[model samples]
Target: MLPRARPTRVVRMPDTSRLDGMTSTVTTPSSESVPRSHPADRTGAQVAADAAAVIGSADLSEAGLRRFLHGLPGVDRVGADGRAAHLGTRSIKTTAKAWALDLTISMVDLTTLEGADTPGKVRSLVAKARTPEPGDPTCPRPAAVCVYGDMVAEARDAVGNSGIRVAAVATAFPSGRAGRQVRLADTRDAVAAGADEIDMVIDRGAFLSGGFRKVYDDIVAVREVCHDAEHPAHLKVILETGELATYDNVRRASWLAMLAGADFIKTSTGKVSPAATLPVTVIMLEAVRDFLATTGVQVGVKPAGGIRTAKDAIKYLVSVNEVAGEPWLDPDYFRFGASSLLNDVLLQRQKLATGAYSGPDYVTID
Candidate 1:
């Protein structure tokens, strides 16, 4: 009887070390909204008492929790441009189904993404990404292009006619440390410019500070604001696993975000170092799997940043295929947040079909 869903607290970097072995606690009665406790404020004794209270009253069954999560509000904005759109048009459904893509965070490490890698540059990169190659068995394009909020419009425009949906990062990306007004405005602006989906960062500092309510409120507000926009942006809450070190903490954040209203739960902004490792993606996808099974809702997963080569993308794909099975293999439920990975994947694909080391551009994929 507990209230359906609750928002999760943000996890800050400075406090991540503290949660290395210990995770925050949520306490709630069976028929009431879950009350989240910030361990940072309460004395050790008080914190332990709250933890015991939560453990005592709440129904911790994953099945029931997942069902409730699946029932949350939000439009399922699956684009027609994914494998569904591409191969369907060609009248060869199997070719489109033959390939799946990673929903990347799309930031390059060699350059300063904010300045040198301006919105225009990002847009250009996106353009190259949407162009299909001659060797493509079905001539199908990638599912989506993910970028910073400022470039969402540019990306949409650049990928025009290619049928790729543009995804924008919001909520003060890389650090969810902005004022509520600022965060809402960012979401509004991104959606206004035609972003189909949003990748938002959670305030890790607040979560670490035991500011669960503050963090939850902020994410919920963004979720609401994102939903209000014309484009009906999909919200992807980034847990910033590098900032949240423990597997338990990652699991907790995954559930909390799912409960809060995340259509997708992604890792890292691709701006932070050590972004998107397999272990973390595994943990998050596991949460996605459980959340889906229990709730009957399908949520997407994006492992952003640090995935540069085809091999890395393949490894991630292999892992997802192994752990989550074929249902989760579609671009709808799986994605990789990479900027430089497409070319390699295409190059490898071409080589596999025709044994020749083609020029970087010969692959016809950017």
Candidate 2:
């Protein structure tokens, strides 16, 4: 049977009681306190410059990571998880269902990151992203195609002028254990090969050991390199929140990425266990929303891995609208990282329109 869409409600901020046992004070800069980016014609250098100004004369030493993290307002575990569960219960129906399905398709990153990935595979993925459904020209294309750095050129070449962006996962992806120099070089190669966005993993070891300075510096260095690239790719910092092990860590990592000038903060590498859960995404969304409120600079968010259904995607949109507001509903600010998700969304769209379930033969398998 087809899954029925349920009614969705506007999620209001939880009560203050939810704040109990959470961090009460945050030392992060407010909108008036932080230096604002140039509103017009901004570039990569401007991002780095604004970040430097934001980090001026602060205690980012090893000992200060905890203090800095604790200084931020704490997250209420129950409140966040409750919000996610509640939002997931929403059933989008009829025209709302159709709208959400299309919006979800638009927000997808259409990822394919496997050790065995090849040029032919990437080209096919690009074709799937562009046409989606061969007979349905009404179907919109996905936002971008995500692949490993090595396959970037192949993907880019195939996606040429289709209005589709090509994103590359770099910096020794999934496990970011490479040295800073190697990671920067990795980013440069991808950009030179025409990657519009670069997804880099952070050294989870550093973050777990309170080496926050190391983590922050690495993101800054990569951001600088991305800006300096001739094509100027946007940087997406993957925190691998499942490894972080707590909402507090997720919130801290989100802020750390934003403070380091990450164009987007991602949930996971999709190569790890427990990739992209609702609670983790919720905390990240809150971080971006709060960052925008405080710095007047908006950074995007991508929740990669484990989100497979059209229902799951729309629930994320509902969260984005409710937690981050309507501004983040656009493809520029939000994206999904998945390979099979496109087919599932296509299947769901067909089911909604025809009053019947779609078999695998009906959609493209990339």
Candidate 3:
């Protein structure tokens, strides 16, 4: 028999004064706090300038990126794991749980990236993204609907002006094995197809083989494609941390992507084992926090794969608050690249509202 649900602790909203240039706030449990819109887009040249400013007089050569990445503070694996485990134990009850459930739903990037994906499947995902809870008008929509480059147009048309973004994976995705020209074309196609955001996978092989400059150039190239687009899509650099093999490497990759002008640094492609572990995410959170402090540039973080339950999502929220501060709590700065996670969050949200669990049938099976 399943154990009865227990009350969880509330995550207190952090002070907004530390949010820097972020004008939007997410305080109350209401959906108003969920970010449904984004700030004006910047051009590719502007983004490059920002990256240059962060680089300062430092070397812009391959050796320079290598030196900088290797120079990042090494992550204490034991300490990170301990901190994440400790935070995971935090429990919230009633109102706080309700708020967290809503926030979790809002942060999701409902994704469907598969060989079997069809236009119909993408449309269903968009519908779910628009209204996660069928009858609850109060339910906040997800931050975005993530799909492949070819399906961007379908997603874009379906989403319309609902304020839900359409994010497409590009730069050859998953393996990122294509050449530079092919990868650039992939990004251009997605942007032209009206994707609001581009999630590009880094060359894990190049990164692991000490080809730091290659990886850096790959991200920079993709970022340029996003910014140069007429719509100026946001660029999310996926580090594929599961293959990165170490906590220290995760930190390096996070900083590397940020310095390369990644609007968001993602953890995985969801095609590998041990994807999106708390410790790896903690390292990433720390990297982004430190990057903001040093460069005055705020970047988002997305942990994809294996985060299916509302419980797991809440733990990540706690880590984001404790490590990166409250600024990241909003959907604008944090996202979950998940497909199954939304349905699970809906189930939990229903349970919290009605005091009774709704089985799997209550939510779509996408």
Candidate 4:
């Protein structure tokens, strides 16, 4: 069993009185409780130095990484489940529901990563991303169009100045089984092809085997690739928490990725069972929250995979508000990596506007 941290109280429910008006009052941890280093404005090298400084080790050896990770606080499984279940039940009024529906649409990554993905299919997906509801101009476009690395140019061409980013999955996505050079090349190719963001999967096998330094080095290498790209694409590290086997591993992996300079720490690759759950997401949110409190560098959290409904998305929004605070409420700080979730959000948005639920055929088939 992993070492457990001192038990702390579960996160409190956020004040939601302003949700109906599209504003929220969330309570953040006081600066005195967690010292801030203001590392966000620093260069990558400075951020890396800051991470090393925080860990109290300049050399990130395997033993050093292991000691630091194990020495961190442990999670209370029962308390986490209870808090997640409690947050999921928060009621959303009509106006707030409408706002959430729109916000969910805008935060979607609008993905399609099948083995048989073609340019035409990617173009179609981009079309839906640009205008989810064709007739209604009020419909907000998705945050980005996510596709396989090879399809980055197609997605980029299709998105074309719509303000929607083009994210590509690289570093042997879904399974980080390739060699380091191959993974780096894969990332370079995607960025060269005009990808605005690169979603790289971590080596779950390495992590499970206690190769903490290997995992950290892998993310650092990928982060360097993203940083060196001509357009400087954002790097989202996919932890594939399903294979991690424990909440403790999830927290460690989250910190490892952030320390290695990942712009975002994602939950899964959407290729595994139990892809994204409230409890798991809550753990990740808490990691980012505490990380921000410590380093003053806010990292984004993306819970990909099984999220597929307007109500479910709203539940996640509530969790974001309550767990990580209001800073993560924007699309830049949070995202839903789903292909089918967009259609559901659109259906709910229509129902709110017309007072009647639209059929599945009303939206384009993703």
Candidate 5:
């Protein structure tokens, strides 16, 4: 006679909204709720790992993930914008201004994604990234050089050993309308080309159509492709906030990306009508702050596009300092995805060093 196997017991998580002042909610399984056999299902560990493979065992079902995002506290658009506007008014003067300018420069992901971007352009961009100001060795280089997937190898070769990384925008970048297989192939190509980081755009059509599962799965697929033993590419999920159209949607998208194993949640692709506004960036900062508080997992934030001047970049730094705290100030935790913004910061740095303001020709063209 054969012994019958015992059936495993599963229970639905209790409703968390009814709880008074619950800082953390469990719409999905809590750490203890997941089976011990599935180490990846452990909420605390998986959240901290922030790896795409871990997300496969995440306790949340498709419906649960949707509920969690929808149940998140709503954003007050006016209040958020007001706070950002007020933060913008804070002045950085003298030595403080000089320090802010340097910090801003260090955070820049100097980007060039044009179809016209050639090896020469990427090499020039790489030279600029390595030495923003050839005359002043004191001036630090920007964090990374961002390019299209096909240009990753060229960018990597040009910026070799300079400590400035090479980031490739993949997965049918800026549009994200390509099929899943094609998107995955695009990401793999970048990684195989030695891209240090991968910035992928989410399918906004799926998101807007309430295809949260599809979006999450897509991110997971890309994240998996980014992982390597010697050189794992950091994944930055771009939500394209302009197309999202609401602060609440931004917040939801931010959470969705974090849950799907995104190392960073980017604000925009910079191709759209409206890109990287203060209010939208504020919402993302809040999402990272709150997400960190609850999951003990910190994800970086990158506000791409529409940031053209040193003043605007400083304002963003200010918001980061006040909202996300000093820990997020590092390049590992924050980034500014800008092309022309780097020139402005460099010019300002020159102005601080010398008494005279530098012209456009003073800085590197790329």
Candidate 6:
């Protein structure tokens, strides 16, 4: 039987009592009260101009690594897993557009969303989700249709009975430049309108501008808005790794986000030039691993944007399995925030199962 769609509800913030034992305190970012250890605090437009002055400038030795790693609740370094050789076969077979997608593409003004060629582009994307043409063999079904605040109800209505999730980018998406009350209100509104998961963009600007405290406080406030029991929408925090730059910086962002109550730590906003890449994902996964060990809180990791093939997804899977150990392999712990790449994964799955390559409709993710 197909999994029944979990109904969306009005999400309430976690109780203050639950906050008693948590490791880190979420703080608002400012010049005076910056977050404790996130290196993203060092990146900004002006700083990027001084790349030559920044490259390999900071100490990244083993001691530096241990200092950051040991701060998390449950972090420990594993020598090497003998299962490292199993990194190659990471593909999932399905059609690209038919499966699911987290339409949380916040890098641009989605209100001016391009490619809405048909009358109901969002509806069409929802309707055509289960159908495919003969010639389109490489596409895979998107996991969900992600959208921002206002469209949650529309997306929910469009995807009715399809058993697909309608995710909304919330907590002041993209820029996350809103005030705390506004951000929390946005999250509450999205959930009430039937959004399944909340994809939040971290305040990269604040984190990069020596305002980690603000960034942390923002995430906690947003998280509070969505922590209800019945309609519990998971939170995915986008780090905008491209803007942050450097593997070490990515690692620090991951730790900070995970510590700040993010259920999943994601890579980019798709608007940024660098987007999601290999090294950034590696760092994020390792951060998740260490955080899980320390705090015993197993958060998820998502690599969004710029992924387009089965091979790419497989590499990410390999990286997760390699760096994070075997326990983090499930979709609950890992997700791909992609729209263009699911088809290639499906095509490859078709070839592996059937001797001959087939068209898009040949496979179904359900």
Top-TM-score candidate index:
4
Model 2: which residue pairs collide?
Answer: 5-91, 6-91, 26-71
lDDT of 3 by residue, 1-366 (tens): 333222121112223233221211323222243322222244445444544445442335677667666765566676667777887989977898899989998999999999899999999999988878888999999999999999999999999999999999998888999999999999999999999999999999998888887888888788888887688899899999999998878877887788788889999999888889887887787776656555455789999999999899999998888777778898989999898888888998889888998999888787
Candidate 1 deviant stretches above 4 angstroms: 1-113, 134-137, 359-366
**Cα lDDT for residue 37, model 4?**
40
Which stretches of candidate 6 lie above 4 Å from their native place? 1-119, 128-142, 358-366
Q: Which scores greater on lDDT, model 1 or model 2? A: 2
**Candidate 1 lDDT over residue span 1-366, tens digit each:** 554323122211111222221111211112122232311223323322322222222333444333333333221123211322222233212233235322221221111135455766766666565554544435455667777777777777887777677788787776777888988899889989998777888888876554544555666677777776666777788889888755556666776676555777888877787788776776666565544443334566778778877656656666565445556566667777665676666665566556776567574332
Q: What is the C-alpha lDDT of each candidate?
A: 0.58, 0.79, 0.80, 0.83, 0.80, 0.57
TM-score of every candidate relative to the true structure: 0.69, 0.87, 0.87, 0.90, 0.86, 0.65
Higher-scoring candidate on TM-score, 3 or 5: 3
What is the model-wide C-alpha lDDT for candidate 3?
0.80
Model 5: CA > 4 A from native: 1-59
TM-score, structure 1 vs. true: 0.69
On the 0 to 100 scale, the lDDT of residue 18 in model 5 is 21
The superposed Cα distance between candidate 6 and the true structure at residue 327, in angstroms, equals 2.4
Task: Select the stronger candidate by TM-score from 1 and 4.
Answer: 4
Q: Is candidate 5 or candidate 6 better by lDDT?
A: 5
Clashing pairs in 3: 8-91, 8-92, 8-93, 9-91, 9-92
- Provide the global lDDT of candidate 1 against the true structure: 0.58
Using TM-score as the measure, name the better of candidate 5 and candidate 6: 5
lDDT of 4 by residue, 1-366 (tens): 334332121222212232111112335665466443432234666656656655656666788788878876677677777778888999996999989998898899999989999999999999988878988998899999899999999999999989999999999998999999999999999999999889999999999999988998898888888887678888899999999988888988998888888788899999999898988888888877767765667789999999998889999999998878877888988999999999998898888889986999898776
